[model samples]
Target: MRTPASQRALLVKISENVCYTELVYQRVNKKLSVDWSHSETEAWVQAILRDPDSLVEQRGKNYYVANQRRKSQLTVNSHNYRLITVNRLSK
Candidate 1:
């Protein structure tokens, strides 16, 4: 079982991205919008949505999520979203 604070941390870590928070809020306002602050690093995520398909195991570290772009779509308009794609860049 996860404590309230721990759960909050996990949610914050996952949704550090703003657009993502807004997306969730739009869908359901139950619990997940209390700590979606605006981060500059995460801002780029919204501006440029990048989703990698693979994880880079370098020095025993999953570099995929580490270097992931935290972004999400807030627009409910289906016409605006043609397709969302993420490219994996590993070397």
Candidate 2:
């Protein structure tokens, strides 16, 4: 099992190369209650991945990046690094 630090490092390293499909983009924004454009939403997700306090976990084929401060979790494909979606954590 990869440690949290290693998972975080690997995820951040691939952040710049990740892909965001239009379908997932719309899905993410709807789930997260955000109206950001494609670029803005991608940047927001990347920021969460790079945040020092964020926790990363791998389950099945997906990487879950969760940030307490942001109150959201971002899901990305482990193999292709394609952003799957994001969800806001309930307060």
Candidate 3:
């Protein structure tokens, strides 16, 4: 298991390298119900990943980042840092 400091560093690195495809952009917008541009969406996701309150964990081949303040969770490919999807958390 990684130490908290290492895990946080890893999350920061992943956040810096995160990428999004057109399909993912569309899907995120639909799921999150916000029509942000590609760059805007990317920034939003990165912010979540970098947030100290967010929880980052690896499951299988993906990194799952969840933030309660944002009320959402995001999944990214571990290998390529490609954004897979994001979903709003239900209260």
Candidate 4:
């Protein structure tokens, strides 16, 4: 089993990007007052990255449960999320 510290680090690393398909978006936002846009999703996942303890559930690679209702069932592939450390330079 992974240590608590190691697991926290892994959560931070994987939360770099929270990937989801259109179907996920539609289903998730169907009852919500606001639409779950990409930017919103990114921000929500980033918040979780900042605080892994906030996660209500971590069920393998397919799902994560955050405190926020809209972000609970998000499909985040930590391995697939690209790590962009630097800001883009303007041409």
Candidate 5:
């Protein structure tokens, strides 16, 4: 019989390996790079992360969120920095 799509090794591996955990008593950890991928998934991933909004395609198997910033007139005058936000959700 064919393997159930949800039970596939690739997807299961991604979930087990990609997610991070922290102790409830301690502050959360921060990461600059979300180091998870396969050659097949890379192009699809780029299509999303490269967007101006910093959003990715988020296929049914996985989700990715991102942050982006552009210089603003007020920020330029005030010498402030641009801001960005990134988030993700997956089933």
Candidate 6:
């Protein structure tokens, strides 16, 4: 499990590859019924990256997941983030 602080840092490192459009942001908040901050969104993105198979499916360049898991705990799906690239940032 990743701490929120680490997740925030990771999000900053991958900010270039992440795309959360206006529509996507709105939809995510609507779905989750919470006004999520950028940190929250980043955390969700990290969770999704950790488990790509959990995604519902790829709709074009976007990946959708109805829910996410932290370890074995389930969480509500907030939004889909398009990963523009998959470079090895770390080993």
Best by lDDT: 3
* TM-score per candidate, chains pooled: 0.21, 0.87, 0.92, 0.51, 0.21, 0.41
For model 1 the local lDDT of residue 56 reads 22
**Global Cα lDDT for candidate 6:** 0.45
| Candidate 1 structure quality by residue, lDDT tens digits, 1-91 | 4554554443344344323344443333323233434353245333332333212221221112223332222222122221122233343
**All candidates' lDDT scores?**
0.32, 0.82, 0.90, 0.49, 0.28, 0.45
lDDT of 6 by residue, 15-43 (tens): 33556556655655665566888668667
On a 0 to 100 scale, what is the lDDT of residue 71 in model 6?
Answer: 26
Q: State the lDDT of candidate 2 residue by residue for 1-91, as single tens digits.
A: 6787787777676576688899998998788777889889878877887788888788899888888899998888989988888888875
Which candidate, 3 or 4, has the higher TM-score? 3
Clashes of each: 0, 0, 0, 0, 2, 0
For residues 23-76, write the lDDT of model 3, one tens digit per residue. 999999999888999989988997898889888889999988889999999999
5 versus 6: better lDDT goes to: 6
Q: Regarding TM-score, does 3 or 5 come out ahead?
A: 3
Q: Which prediction has more favorable lDDT, 3 or 5? A: 3
What TM-score does candidate 4 get on C-alpha atoms?
A: 0.51
Best-to-worst ranking by lDDT: 3, 2, 4, 6, 1, 5
The residue pairs found clashing in candidate 6 are: none
Assess candidate 3 and give its lDDT: 0.90
Residue 28 of model 5: what lDDT?
16
